[model samples]
Structures are given as structure tokens and as C-alpha cells.
Target: MHDIAPYLLQNDLGGESLVEFEHEEGWDLIVVNLARAIDRHVRHQAKIDPESYDLDLIYFSQVKEKKGSLRAYVTMPDAIINAYVDFAELMSETTCEVTGRPGLLHTKMGFVKTLHPDVAAERGFKPVD
Candidate 1:
């Protein structure tokens, strides 16, 4: 999170405002990078056209994993930001949710997840068919 701390509103608002994630530790970097990218773009845009940028649509409202992928819910919609979100969500599909390693979808006893090959094998999961 330190990587993105400077780009987060929590730093300005104080008391843990921007740090929130409802997912495994592996995707931590993914979330951090995503936030950083989004924040950078918005701040840049805001500076260029202060009157057109809506602060309301600049922050994330929810971030969670659903069906082995990421869901980043922004308070409001911005077409450009949506493109970044879309890319991140697709990236999560091939990332391990436990170790941040390259991974693929697997299933263990009917539970589904994205995990590194080693992590999946150790956990008794097989590649999803």
C-alpha cells in the first residue's frame, strides 16, 4: 500500500479512508497499482480542467473479488477511469489471489480460485475444466 499511499485520499482525509479491499493478499499489489493509476489520471485531468472534473466521481466506493476477478466500484462513473478498471479486472483473472504469482483458475472441492500452480497443487486444487 505504501506504493500508492501518496495517491490515496485516505492520506488527506486521515484515519484509514482509502485503504479497503475485500480479497486475498496476493491481489494486494494489483489493487494498489490500480488505485495509483486511477488517481494519477484523475489528478492530472482535474488540474487541466478543474471546472469539468467532478470530485464525486474520482474516488472508489468498493473494491472486492467476485467470481475470481476484481470489481472496483467507483462512487460515480467516468469513461476514462472505466477503461483502467476494465483492464485491471481482466488482469486479475490470470493472477494468483494468494501469492501474487502468475496463475490460472483452479477448483478444490468445488471451491474456485485463481492461484499459482504450486499453490494450487499444494492446496489440492486442479485446473478448472
Candidate 2:
């Protein structure tokens, strides 16, 4: 897992060991996207109300059965959970599990359904046919 401790410390999230996993081929991009999403959410919230949305606590748990699956546990005062989930869903769509394809066309829905069913319902997410 590239030692998420450094990243967390750099972001001032404290040095709390969250989870560990083997580093996969394309997992770096996924993590980058997730961090971006969370950072964006935090910045936006800070703009709205600096005092209330000051702290953001999020942790990731690696799902052993699923190769590239990372479950996020968020503990923020605001409703930014959906934002993180949405970014995860988006990353899942872009990542390809098989040969020379642009996207994971077959497993997109199943991924979102399994990981973030509530997000799917909230965003009216459906298969891109």
C-alpha cells in the first residue's frame, strides 16, 4: 500500500494507521482521485463555514477479497461522504480489469452497487449503455 502514513501526515490528518494492502498496478490513480475529492470537499466547506468544517477524519480499509477495493470510513461534521463515494465510483468506472479496454464496462454497476448503494440511489446512477 505505499505507506499512507506519509500522505496523511502531509495533509495534517495525523499519523493514525488506518489500513494496509498490497500495491496494485492502477491503485495509485484511484487513491490520488480520492484524495483530490476529499480535499475539494474540505476546501468548499471551509469557504462556507471555516469554524464548523475544520476537522476531517477519514480512514481506508482494504478489502482482501476484492483486489482494488478500499472502503472509506469518514468522520466529518459535514455531509461530504457522498462526495468521496462519488469519486470512488468514478474511479471504479475508469479502471479496467481486463485487456485493451477503455473502462471496466462489465463490472461498473456491480462495483457501485456493492460499495455505495446509497450513493447510487442518491445520484440516480445507472449502467452506461
Q: Count the backbone clashes (under 3 Å) in each candidate.
A: 0, 0
Q: In candidate 1, residue 24 scores what lDDT?
A: 92
TM-score of every model?
0.80, 0.48
Please write out the lDDT profile of model 2 over residues 34-83, one tens digit for every residue. Answer: 65666666667769988765643434433121533434444452456566
Give the Å shift of residue 65 in candidate 2: 6.8
What are the RMSDs of all candidates, in order? Answer: 3.0, 9.7
Off by over 4 Å in 1: 2-19, 54-57
TM-score winner among the candidates?
1
Question: How does each model score on lDDT?
Answer: 0.76, 0.45
